[model samples]
Target: DAGVTQSPTHLIKTRGQQVTLRCSPKSGHDTVSWYQQALGQGPQFIFQYYEEEERQRGNFPDRFSGHQFPNYSSELNVNALLLGDSALYLCASSPQRGWDNEQFFGPGTRLTVL
Candidate 1:
């Protein structure tokens, strides 16, 4: 089965522009979560989507939003980006109906804002 995949492997943007990153979840999974990892920092949960609806959100700002499709794939959008937004944007997937499932992470789409 195909594992999680992310696009553009790397990205560079200005401080005020917007960027959209994509993710395809592993086969048979229904939950998608987005995380942000700054340089030398652990991944920080951004939000999670299940049943095509956002179920939980972390301590990120409104600029960070996401969407999940019926097929379980997902996209994360960051608007009005900042230099601080430069980090590895990781997408994780889990089977929603299962117990405290561990998330499988993508290699991540690194974003650098100048």
Candidate 2:
């Protein structure tokens, strides 16, 4: 069973640009969630997708959007990025229909905006 994987372990971008980060969920999982973790802060949930539909979402701007594919993988898209967007983007996976399920995180994709 493979664990979650994220692309471009690290990324650098300038303010006002757009970025897309990809994630592949763990085997046998159908739920994918995205989180943003600033330095010294706990992960903040962005949104969660199950069965290819968003089931839950957190308080984030419209700039933060995501998509889950049939393969159970997901992609997080951020538009008109700001310097504040610079943080660790984490992808978490859990079994479907289990809110109490423990989420497994990926190594994360570090984004640096200048």
Candidate 3:
């Protein structure tokens, strides 16, 4: 059994660059959500994916996108990145089932844009 895992732990890029972050869900989890947390701010919902389809999205621009695999893994993609996009990208997983599903978060991937 494994907890949620995210790739690259950290990343650095320049403005206008593109970045892709990956996430592997915890065992028994079926839904994955992506969040962005800027310095000193709480995590803001970016979007959520389930069953390979986007289920919900936040007020972010079209540059944000995501994909969920049949194995419950997911990826978060951001295009035309801006300095304002620099933040900790978190991946959370929960069972897309009946009530009482608890979400578990992974160590976030820190993005630094110059």
Candidate 4:
């Protein structure tokens, strides 16, 4: 069975630009989480979407936003991008939102901002 998948494996943007990254959840999954991983750093949780609503978020600024579609796919939108935004954006999907639920992650979308 196909697992979570992301698009635009690589991307480049300039400061103050906006970018949107896509994610398709694994079959039978209904929750999606977004994370940003800087070089040599662990993935930092951005936010999570469930039932098409923003369920939880981390310390990320308001520039980071996301949406969950009826099909369980998602899109992460970053506005007014900064050089610090350069990182690998990861998407993870799980059957449900809970600490016990196992999440499957996509390879990731690398975003570089100049």
Candidate 5:
């Protein structure tokens, strides 16, 4: 079965520009988490949303935002992009009813900021 999926496998942007990435959760999952992984670094949690409500967020600034749809799909939006913003954006999905459940990750969207 298909698992979590992300769109725009690759992206390129200039500093100060904005970008939006999309994701669809795995089957039977309603919780989606977004992560940012820099080169040679592990993924860092950005945020998680469930039931169309944002439930948790990490250290990222307000320039990063997300929205979860009723169908468990989600989108991550970044504004005022910087060169440091270049990274792979990941989307993971898990069942919200379970605590600390296993999250299935998408292939991620590689973003490069010039």
Candidate 6:
């Protein structure tokens, strides 16, 4: 019955550091995807997970990774962060992909890199 949730509404980090963002998907949902939204831009797909496995990945570098738990919760990890990495990290969830079921988005974790 709950919708997607993300931790740390705002975060500040320095270059070369690593940050981990968390997400709890909506109830009864089994798919979660991460996105990066820069200022004034729509989100760019980072990757997606289903059935506790990564099923699809975007054009992002290996520094970006994610994990999905059996419970449908997920985590987004960014390593060796750069100032350019600063953006809004959004987590979305749906019953599953391919079906294009309704997806709910989190409030997003805003990151600022120095």
For residues 60-80, write the lDDT of model 2, one tens digit per residue.
999999999999999999999
Q: What is the C-alpha lDDT of each candidate?
A: 0.92, 0.94, 0.94, 0.96, 0.96, 0.92
Candidate 5 displacement at residue 4 in angstroms: 0.6
Q: Which candidate is the best by TM-score?
A: 5
The parts of candidate 5 lying over 4 Å away from their true place are none
Higher-ranked by TM-score: 2 or 5: 5
RMSD of each: 0.8, 0.8, 0.9, 1.1, 0.7, 1.2
Model 2 CA lDDT for position 107: 97
**Which parts of model 1 have CA positions greater than 4 angstroms off?**
none
Candidate with better lDDT, 1 vs 3: 3
TM values, all candidates: 0.97, 0.96, 0.96, 0.97, 0.97, 0.95
lDDT of 3 by residue, 7-114 (tens): 989999999999999999999889999999999999999999988999999999999998988899999999999999999999999988863766899999999999
Q: Of models 1 and 4, which has the larger lDDT? A: 4
- Please provide the root mean square deviation of candidate 6 (C-alpha atoms, Å): 1.2
Put down candidate 4 lDDT per residue, 1-114, tens digits, no spaces. Answer: 999999989999999999999999999899999999999999999999999999999999999999999999999999999999999999999988475877899999999999
Worst 10 residues of 4 by lDDT: 94-103
Q: What is candidate 6's lDDT per residue for 4-109, written digit by digit as tens?
A: 9999899999999999999998887789999999999999999999988899999999999999887889999999999899999999998864556667899999
Per-candidate count of clashing residue pairs (backbone under 3 Å) = 0, 0, 0, 0, 0, 0
Q: After superposition, how far is residue 82 of candidate 2 from its true place, in Å?
A: 0.4
The C-alpha stretches of model 6 lying farther than 4 A from their native spots are: none
lDDT of 5: 0.96
Native-to-model Cα distance after best TM-score fit, residue 70 in candidate 3, in Å: 1.5
User: What are the clashing pairs of model 4?
Assistant: none
Model 1: how far residue 73 lies from native, Å? 0.8
lDDT of 5 by residue, 1-114 (tens): 889999999999999999999999999999999999999999999999998999999999999999988888999999999999999999999998885778899999999999
